[model samples]
Target chain A: MLIDIQNLVKDYQMDSVDVAALRGINLQVQKNEFVAIMGPSGSGKSTLMNILGCLDNPTSGVYRFNNTDVTGLNDDELSDIRNKHIGFIFQSFNLLKRMSALENVELPLMYAGIDKAKRMAMSKQALEKVGLADRMKHRPSELSGGQRQRVAIARALVNNPGMILADEPTGALDTTSSMEIMDVFKQLHTEGNTIIVITHEREIAACCKRIILIRDGLITSDTPNLN
Target chain B: MQQIRDNITKAILSLIDHKFRSFLTILGIIFGTASVIAMISIGEGTKKQAIAKYQDLGVSNIIIRDKDMTDAELQTVRMKFSKGLSVEDAKVISDVVPGVVSVSPQSEMKMEAKVGDRSAKASVIGVTPNIVSILNYRTAKGDFLTTDQYDRQLKVCVLGASIARELFSYDEPVGKSVKVEDQWFEVIGVMQPKALFTETVGELASRDLNNDIYIPLSTFNKRIPKVNPFTSDVKQLTVKLGNSEQLLPAAVVVRSLLNRRHFNNDDFSIIVPYELMKQEEKETRIYNLLLLSIAAISLVVGGIGIMNIMLASVLERTQEIGIRRAVGGKKKHIMSQFVTEAVVLSVAGGIIGVILGVTLSLVISWTTAVQTTITLYSILMAFSFSVIVGITFGYLPAKQAANLRPIESIRHE
Candidate 1:
């Protein structure tokens, strides 16, 4: 198993009231799996993704990545896990506005302390993989919605992490751009990459090999997608 | 090292992205550093000028001047058997005082000097041969009076530079005959112009030295009749000491001697240039300290301005900070990034401030009578102070930036 979670609970303090965002969730993910976590608004799906991505720690639980207990790790250790093992892709793309596509892709590598020459080479290869080889010099404001998402994907893939955790990866795209982004995900899955996407759309969930449905902070259904 | 370089590059790029905002942010530091440099330079220049003026007065010399009085006062002093400041006082100081190098006595009488039809009001000063060496006077043309001339009581005189120019125009005044009052005296030398004394020292009145004529004391006493029978033989006595360390002691000895010789009458005052110089230095030290504190306050205020801007910057870039934190940037990385930004701003401001300060000092010297000296240490101090201010003020904002929670900040939007 690449990811293991047990009895995960997250509570947010809101104006003197403890709101349970995630209630006693248990999950396990195997290597090279394409998984989609589906839920409506306020179902705690984003909170779960945040915990899974090592961006946030659970209030109480055991999270093991590659057999290492991650829940007990400190802030810097968690950042290292996020940098080396889990890559994040957001719905809004989150590409740095002032940087070109290549520079945005190079950001993670730069944080990883890679030298300039190799960082450039790796970022270029990632852009080529995302079919954005010619748009490397274009800034986020200069690119269309689909192209910006492609740059985000290139950035996520540049570090070659154990898993790519994308939250609502196609939530802001048109049908045509959505299909294009989904095709890229399918191609990456065929290339033996482990992927987990959080979304609410049924069509987006149907593209994954397995789907987990969450309602009211609990897992409602976990099964292989028939599509 | 590489991390620091990357952070610096990011800082510079971000500042360049918002050019006008960055410039405004550093304005306080610019003015602070410039004022610091300017203030210190002005203080230094004032000190140097004071020292030069004091040096011209011969710091190791002590002067005694006769008190100016009306004829009634002079008659009373004579009735009391006090001779005022006479050549006998100079002879007594030279003979009795220990560590006294030399003594020169001088007397002045204001009269009209004429060459042909051109005439100028000049103070005819009668001095002994040793007066030139005692007072640092130099002759620009011909030679000064010798002991032979003084002993022989020759009616020769040394014309002051301005008096020579006034009477003779461009022609050499040496060996020319000039009518002084009712007597015709031959000019043997002309003196170089001396620095003007604008303020009185003790009982000594300020006067234009370059308009005076110098003659042998023996000739002056025989030719120039006394304005009043109660007047003293000489007006002033200049006593040179072996070294500056003996000035106070010699002054004390000379004062007591004069008091006795004048029959316990307070008719003369002693002025020690070295003591006056030391007193002036002490006063200016307090003044310089006050100026430095004011400059320091401005720098602190400039530092506060940097903190204000940096705090706002951290707030506005919360999302950016989160993004950077999410991308494997550690807390130290974030902290150093912002700190480097602050340092860059201040260093740029420091360079500009140095340039502005040098220009300001130059402009001050050119436009006003007040002198300004820009020293290397002042520049270095101002520049380093600005850097220190940046780091000090930059710490709080950078810590706030580093301590932000990534999860919350990422979703701040």
Candidate 2:
């Protein structure tokens, strides 16, 4: 198993009151599974995604990644795991505006302490993989919305991590741009990359191989999306 | 290494992006560093000038001068059996005082020196042949007086630098004839240019050493007549010591001896150049301290300015920090990046400040009477101080940037 979680609970302080964002959830996923976590707003899907992405600590849980318990990992260790194991993409395309598309794609490897020549070659290859090879010198502001999102995806794929965690990746796109993004995801899935996307859009969720529904901090349905 | 390079690149780009803000941010550092170098240069220059002035007077020497007085006052001292500072006093001091090297007596009479119808006012000084070695006086042309010529009472003289230039504008001064107050004298030598005292030193009257003529004491005594009948045989006694450490005790001994010899008339005064130099050094040291404290105050204010801008920068770049953190940048990475940015700002400011300070020093030396000296150490000290200020003040904002939560900041607008 690539990821395992049991009895996960998350509580946050809101105005001096303890609000439960996640209440006793259990889930497991094997490697190379394209999964969609579907939920409405305030349904705690983000809280679960944050925990799984190693961005936050669960209040209590057993979270094992690749058979190693990650629940008790310190901040630096979690950052290392995020650097080497998980790639994240966001809906609004959180690309640094000051950098060109190539530099944005090179950010993760720069943090990994890779040298210049090698990092450049790897970033170029990643951008080429995302079909953004010609737009490498363009900044995010100079690119259209779809091209900017593609640059963000190139950044996410640069590290070649074990899985990609995307939070509402298509929520900001129009229908045509969203369809084009799904086509890219289908190709990535065919190439056997494990992907987990969190979104409330029905069409985006249906494109994944597995679907998990969450409501009020609880998992309501788990099924293979054969559509 | 690559990480650090990237961080520095990002810092330079960011600074270039906001040119006006960066300039405003480092204004305090620029002024502080400039003040540090400029103030120290001015202080050092003043100190060096004072030292050179004292050194020209001879640090290990004590002077006994005849008090300026009216003829009535001179006659009163003369009747009281006090002949003022004289050749006899010089002889007694050299003979009786411990650590005494030699005593050279001198007499001065201001008169017009004429050469080929060209004339200039000059103070004609008379001295023994030994005065050259005792006072370290050097000649630029020919030689000083010899004992043979002095004992024979020859009417030969040496011209001071300005007097030579005045009496013979193009002709060679040595072996030429110069008339002084109706007496004709052959010039045997010309003295080198000496430093001019711009201000009065202690009780010593300010006068140009370059505008004097030197002649043998025997020739002066036989040919020159005293304006006042009650005037002493000599005008001043210059006493040299073996070392500077013996100056005060030697002065005390000379004073007591002179007091008894002159019957306690107070007709003469003793001036120690070494003692006066020490007092001036102390005064300048205090003045330098005051200037340094004011510069330090500006440096502190500059550090605060850096802190203020860095804090604002952290707030503005929250989303950027979040993006980096999500891409696996550790807290230390973020911390180093921001600190590097601050250091870049200060170092740029420091470089400009050093240039300005050097220019200010040159301007001060040129436009005003104040002298300025620029040393390498002052530049190093000011530059290092700015770098330290960058690191010290940049820490708080860097910590704030590092400690920001990636989850919340990524979502922040």
Candidate 3:
């Protein structure tokens, strides 16, 4: 298994009240598995995704990635885990507006302490993978929405992370751009990349090989998506 | 080091992006450095001027002056002591004072000097032949009074430069005759221009040297009567010491000897030019320190400004920090990045300020009468101090930047 979440419980403090965002969630994702987490707003699917992405720690339970327990990690250690193992793609693209597409892609390699020339070459190849080879020098502001999302994808793939964790990957795009991004994800998964996506749209979720449905912080169903 | 270079490049880009903000941030540092350099330069210039002025007076010389007194006081002095200063004191000091190199005595009498159609009020001084060598006085014409002239009591006078110009424009004053209080004195030589002391010389009140006319001491005694019944015979004496180190002790010895001669009445005052020069240098050192401290305070304040701005910048760039951290940057990397940026900012400010300070000193010297000399050491010192300030004050902000939470900060709007 690339990611293993067992009996996860997460909570938030609102003033003095303990509001549980996730309670008793369990799931397992194997290497090269294309998984989609689906639920309506306030259904705790986002909370589950946060825990899975190493962006937030489970208040109580175990999250193991590649046989290493991630739930007990400290903030910096968790950051290292995120940097070395997980690649995140957000709904809003989250591209640093000040940086060019190439620099954005080189960011992961920078954290990896890769030298400049090698980092540039790796970033260039990643951009080429997303068919943005000619758009490397353009800032996010100058790029189209589809092009920006491609750069973000290139950044996620640059470090060769274990799994690409994306939240609402197609939320901010038109139909054509959405299909184009999904096509890249399909190709990445076909190339043996583990892809976990969080979304409520059935058509977007159908792009993945499996679906896990959650409601009110508990898993409701886990099944394969044949289509 | 490569991380620092990358950070510097990013900082330069950011500074370029926000040009006005960066300039405003470094303004205090610029002014602080400029003022520091300018202040030291001016103080050094003034100190040099004072030393040069004193050197012109001959540093090893000790001056003795007849104390200014009311007629009643003079009469009382005459009653208690034999009388006030006289040529006899110079003879006694030369003969008895162990370290005395030479003694020159002079007497002054107020008179009007006339040559052709010009007339000027001048103090006719009765000086021995040795006055020229003892006081470093140079003659422009004929010659100073000789021992034979003093013995013959010849009515010959040496004109001061200003008096010479006034009485004998275009004509050589030497060998020409000038009338002084109904006595015709032949002009023997014209003395070089002397430094004008604006303040009093010890117990002697201030007198203008420009109006002085010199004559042999013997001639003055034979030809002119005393201006006041109790007035000292010798108005002043210049005593040259063997070495500068012996100057204070020699002054002390000469003072005690004069006191014995005057029967314990303090009718004469001694002035040591070397001692006064040392005292002035000490005072100027304190003055220079005060200037440096004030400039240092401004630099500290400038540093605080940089710190404040950098802290605000870190706060504003929290998302950028989170982003960098997410990409694999360690704490040291982040620390070096911000620190490098800060150092670059200050170094740039320092270079600009050094250039500004040099220009400011030059401008001050040109626009005003006050002299200013910009030294290379001062520029280097100011520049290095500015860089240090940047590092010291920028440390806190850089640490704060490096310590930010990556996940939470990245999600910050």
Candidate 4:
């Protein structure tokens, strides 16, 4: 198992009242699995994704990633884990507005303390893989919607993390742009990259090999997609 | 180190982004440093001039002058068997006082000096031949009065540089005859211009030396009358000490000898140039301290401005900080980055301020007749102070930035 969550419970304090965001959740994700998490609004899908990405910790549970318990880790350690093992792609294509496509891809390597020359080479390779080799010098503001999303994908893959967790990766794009982003994800998956995307569109989820449906912070159904 | 370079590059870009705001922020520092350097340089320059002026008057000399006495005081002194300052008192001081190098007595009488066509009222000084070596007066045109001229009571006079020019313009004053007190005297020499000693000496009043006429003491006694009943025979006595450090001791010995000779009437007072020099130095030091404190306050205020902007910069770049942290930047890295930016700004400002300060000091000295000397230590001091101010004020903001939470910051809009 690449990720193991045992009896996870996440709660928020609203004026001294414990409002549960996720209650008694248990799940496991194996290596090389292209999984899609589908849910409606307020279904705790975002909260679950936050916990999975190490942006937030479970209120009470054991979260083991690659056999290391992550729930007890501190913020700095969690950041290290996020840098090393988890790659995040947001729906809005969260590339720094001031940086060029190449620089956006080099950010994670910079945090990892990689030397500049090697970081540049690796960033160039990541951009080429995303079909944005010629657009590496262009800022996100200058790129098209599809090109911005491709830059974000290039940044996510630059660190060679254990998994890519994208939340609504195609939510801000037109049909053609969305199809293009989806094709990149499909290609990544085919190249043996573990990918997880959270979205409500059934067609967007249909490309995944497996799907997990959640409602009200509880897993409702887990099954393979029939394509 | 790489982080610092990146942070400095980013800081420069950010400052360039808001050029006007950044300029306003460093204005206080600029003026503060410039003013500090200027004030210190001016103060130091004035101090050096004052010391040099005093040095020209011979810091090792002790002067004793005859006080102006009333008729009743003169009668009382005469009744108590006391004759006021005289040649005899100078003789006793030179014979008895230890460590005294030389003693010269001088008498002054305001008199008219006349050349062939020019006549000027000059203060005539009657002194012995020893007065020349003791007072450090050099002859510009002819020789000074010799012992033979003094013993024979010959009618000879030396004109001061200005008086020579006034009495004999374009003519060699060495062979000219000048009339003094309705008596004829040949001009022996022209004395060089002495340093202008503006302030009054103890018990001795001030007089301009530019229009002076020097004659022999024996001649003055024989030709000039004892007109003023309260006036002493001797006008002033300048005593030179072998070493400057022995001036105070010499003054004390001469004072006691004079008091005994005058029957403890205190008719004469002594002045030591070394004491006055020390006192002037003390006053100038206090003035320098006050100036330096004011400059220091301005530097601190400048530092505060830097801190204010740095905090705001950290807040504005929240997402950037989050991203950097996400990539792998440790807290130490972030802290050093902001600190380095601040240091770069302050160092650059320091160098510019130094240039500005030196230029300002030079301008001030030129426009006004003041002297200014910019030393290397002053520039180094100002530059280092700026850097220290940056580090002191940059710490809090840098720490605040380094301690930011990465998780929530990443999701911030």
Candidate 5:
């Protein structure tokens, strides 16, 4: 199992009032699986994505990644997991605006402590995989929305992590750019990379092989898509 | 090492992206460092000038001067059997005091020095040949008074540089005849121009040494009659010691001996140049410390400016920090990135400040009467202080940046 979570709970304090953002969520994701988490606003899917990406810790849970319990890991150890095992893509394409496409792709590898020459070679290969080889030197602002998403995908794939966590990966694109990003995700899935995308758009979620619906801090349904 | 290199590269890029803001942020550091260098250079120059002046006065020597008294006071001293300061006092101090090397007694009389049609008021001094060694006086032309001149009672004189110039214009005063107080004397030498004494030392009044003419003691006593009958035979005595270590004890003995010789009249005062030099050095050291602290305060103010800018920068880039943290950067990495940016800003400011400081010091030395010296250590100290200030003031901002939660910051608009 790449990720296994059981009885996960997350509580946030707001003005001295305890609000439960995630409560008793159980899920398992294996290697090479294509999963989509679907929910409305404030449905706790975003909080689950944050926990899955190691950006936050659950208040109470057993989160085991590659058979190692990660729930009790400290900040440094969790950062290591995020660097070496999990790659994240964001809805807004979260590419560092000051860096070139190649530099943005090299960010994860830089945090992984990879040497420079290898990092360059791997970033170049990843950009080429996303069909952005000729645009490697262009900054994110210089690229179109579709191209920027492609660059972000390159960054996500450069580290060759065990899984890729994307939050609303296609929510910022037009129909054409959204289709292009979906095709890239499908291509990545065919190459045996585990991909989990969080989105509310049914058309975007329908492109995934499996869909998990969440509502009000609870998982409502877990079903495999055959379309 | 690679991490640090990457952080530095990122910092440079970010600073370049916001060039005007970064420049404004380091302005305090630049002015602070420049002022530090300028102040230290000025202080050092003043110290060097003072040391040279004291060294020229002969650090191992003590001076005694006769009190300036009216004729009535002089008559009272004469009636009390005190002849003021005399050649006998010089002889007794050298002969009886331990650690005494030599003594030179001198008498001064103000009179008009005449050469041809030109006449200028000059202090005519009578001295033995030993005055040159005891007081570090040198001759610029010909030779100083010799033992032969003193023993033969020759009517020969040495003109001071300014006096020679005043009476002779461009012509050489040596081998020329100058008349003083109706006595004609041949000039054998011209003394070098000495530094001006702007302030009095003890009871000695400030006077321009270059406005004086020198004559042999025997000739002076024979040719120059006292305007007032009760005037002393000699007016000043310079005593040299073998080493400065015995200056205090020797001065004590000399003072007591003079008191006994004058029958406790207190008609003379002693001035030790070495002791005065030490006291001046202590005073200037306190002054330098005050200047340094003021400069340091400016540097600290500059540091606070940096911190203020950096804190604002961290707040402005919250989403950027979130992206870095979410992408796998640890707290240390984020911390180093901000710190490196702060360091780069301060170091650049330090370099520019050094250039400005050196220029300011040179301009001060060129345009003003005050001397300024730029030493290598002062430059290095200013530069290092700026760098330290950057790191020290950068800590709080960098910590605030590093401790930000990725989940919350990513959601921050």
Candidate 6:
């Protein structure tokens, strides 16, 4: 299993009152599985994504990633796991505006302490994989919405992380651009990379190999996509 | 090493993004460092000038000058058998004081030096020929007075550089005769110009040595008539000591010996150039400390300015911090990045400040009479001080930037 989460509980302090963002959740994801986590607004889907991405801690649970217990890891160790094992893609295509596409793609590798020359080559290869070979030097503002998202994906892939966790990665794009992003995801899945995309859109979820629906801080459904 | 380089490049690029803000931020540092270097230069220059002035006075020498007093005071001293400062005092001090090298007695009388129709008021000083060695003076054009001249009481004198130029504006003074008051004296030599006297030393009045005339003391006593009946035998004694370590003790010995010989009349004062130089150095050190402290305060203020700007920058770049954290950057990495930016800012400021300070020192020395010396240690000191300020002030904001929660910041608009 790439991720084995058991009875995860997450709580929040909203105006001095205990509010549970994710409650009593048990989920497991295997290697090379393309999964989509879907939920409406305030259904705790984003909270789940935060925990899965190692950006936050579950109030209580066992989160074993790559067969290592990830719970109770210090901030630096969590950062290490995030750097070497998990890659994050954001809805707004969070590419650093000041950096060129290639430079943006090199961020994770830099955090991994990769050598500069090898980092450059690896970033270039990642960008080329995302079909942005000609746009390596272009900044995020200079690229179209789809191209910027592709750059974000290239960044996610550069460090060769075990799983790609994208939270509504195509939410800011037009329909055609969203379709192009889904196609990139499909190609990566076919290449045996485990991908987890968090989105509420039905069509985006339909393209995944398996889908899980979350509601009211609990998993409502989990099933393989038949089409 | 690569991580640090990456942080530095990132910092540079980001600072370049807001060039105007960066410039404004480092302005305080520039002025602070510049003032540090410039003030130190001025202080060092002033010290060097003082040292040169003392060197001209002879650092290993002590001087005793007769106090100028009213006739009543002079009569009171004479009645008490105190004939003021005399040649006997020089002779006794050289013989009695331990570590004494030699002594030369000198007398002065203001007289008009006339060469042809050109006339100038000059102080005519009379001294033994041995004064040339005791006071370390040299003749520029011709030889100084010989012992034969002093033994024969010859009416021959050496004109001071300024007096020579005044009496012989178009002719050579060494081979000519000049009229002093009513007596005519042949000019044997011209003395080299000495440093200008701007302050009174002990009881020695502030007068230009270059405007004086040098003659044999026997000639002065025989040829020149005293206007006042209570006039002392000689005006001053320049006592040379063997070494500076013996200056104070030798001065004390000479002072008490003179006190007994003159009946404790308090008619003379002793001045040690080495002691005066030490006092001046102490005063300059205090003054330099004041200047340095003021400069240091400005550098601290500059650091505060950097801190303020960095705090605002950290706030503005919240999203960037979030992105980097999400991409696996540790808190230490974020801290290093911001601190690197601050260091780069201050180092840039330091370079500009050093250049400005050196130029300002040069300009000051160029345009004014004040001297300025730019030392390498001052440059290094100012530069390192700025770098330290950058690090000290940069840390807080970097910590703030590092501690920012990534999830909330990323979700922030």
Listed per model in order, the count of residue pairs whose N, CA or C atoms clash below 3 Å is: 0, 0, 1, 2, 0, 0
CAPRI tier for the interface of model 3: acceptable
Write the residue-wise lDDT of candidate 5 on B1-413 in tens digits: 99889888888889999999999999999998999999999999988778767776689988888988888888888889998888888889989999989998888988999999999999999999998988788999999999999989999999988999999999988898998868899999999998877666556677788998999888888889988888889988988999999899999999999999999998888989889889988999999999989998999999999999999999999998998898889999899999999999999889999999999999999999888989999999999999999999999999999999999887777
For model 6 chain A, the run of ten residues with the poorest summed lDDT: A154-163
- TM-score, structure 2 vs. true: 0.96
Task: Give the alpha carbon lDDT tens digit for every residue of B253-295 in model 4.
Answer: 8888888888998887787867887898899899889998999
Clashing pairs in 4: A111-B327, A111-B328
**Candidate 3 clash pair list:** A111-B328
lDDT of each: 0.90, 0.90, 0.85, 0.84, 0.91, 0.92
- The count of backbone overlaps in candidate 3 is 1
Classify candidate 1 by CAPRI docking class: medium
Return the lDDT, model 5, position B373. Answer: 87
TM-score against native, each model = 0.91, 0.96, 0.81, 0.83, 0.94, 0.95
Query: Would candidate 4 be rated incorrect, acceptable, medium or high by CAPRI criteria?
Result: acceptable
Judged by DockQ relative to the true structure, which candidate is superior, 3 or 6? Answer: 6
**Pairs with backbone N, CA or C atoms under 3 Å apart (clashes), candidate 2:** none
Off by over 4 Å in 5: B114-119, B155-157, B168-192
lDDT string, candidate 6, B1-413, tens digits: 88888888888989999999999999989999999999999999999988877877789999898988898899999999998888888889888999988898988999898998999999999999988887678999989999999999999999889989988985888879999998999998999998887777655667888998999999998889988889998998999888999999888888889999999999988889889889999999999999999999999999999999999999988998999999899999999999999999999988998898899999999999989999999999999999999999999999999999989888766
The per-residue C-alpha lDDT of model 5 at residue A181 equals: 93
Q: Write the per-residue lDDT of candidate 1 for residues B1-413, one digit (tens) a residue.
A: 88778878888999999898888888888888999999999999988887776666778899888888889988888889998888778889999999999999988899999999999999999999998888788999998999999999999999888899999999888888999988999999999998776666555577888898999998998889998888899888889999999999888888888899999888878888778889888998899889988988988888888899999999988987888787777788889989999999888878888898889998999999889999999999999999999999999999999999987888777
Chain A TM per prediction? 0.99, 0.98, 0.98, 0.98, 0.98, 0.99
Ranking by lDDT: 6, 5, 2, 1, 3, 4
Indicate the residue-level lDDT of B373 in model 1. Answer: 92
- The window of 10 residues in a row where model 2 chain A has the poorest summed lDDT is A180-189
Query: Where in model 1 is the C-alpha error above 4 Å?
Result: A190-192, B115-118, B128-135, B138-194, B216-219
Candidate 4 off by > 4 Å: A190-192, B69-83, B86-95, B102-234, B242-245, B369-373
Please write out the lDDT profile of model 4 over residues A1-227, one tens digit for every residue.
88899988999888999888888788899988999999998898988998898877889989999899988888678878878888888887878877889988988887777888999999999999999999999989999999999998888889999699999999998889988888999999888788999999888998898999988888889999878
What tens digits encode model 6's per-residue C-alpha lDDT throughout A1-227? 89999999999999999999999899999999999999999999999999998999999989889888888899999899889888899998888889999999999999999999999999999999999999999999999999999999999988888699999999999999999999999998888889999999999999998999999999999999999
Q: Candidate 1: what's its TM-score on chain B?
A: 0.91
Measured by DockQ, the strongest candidate is 6
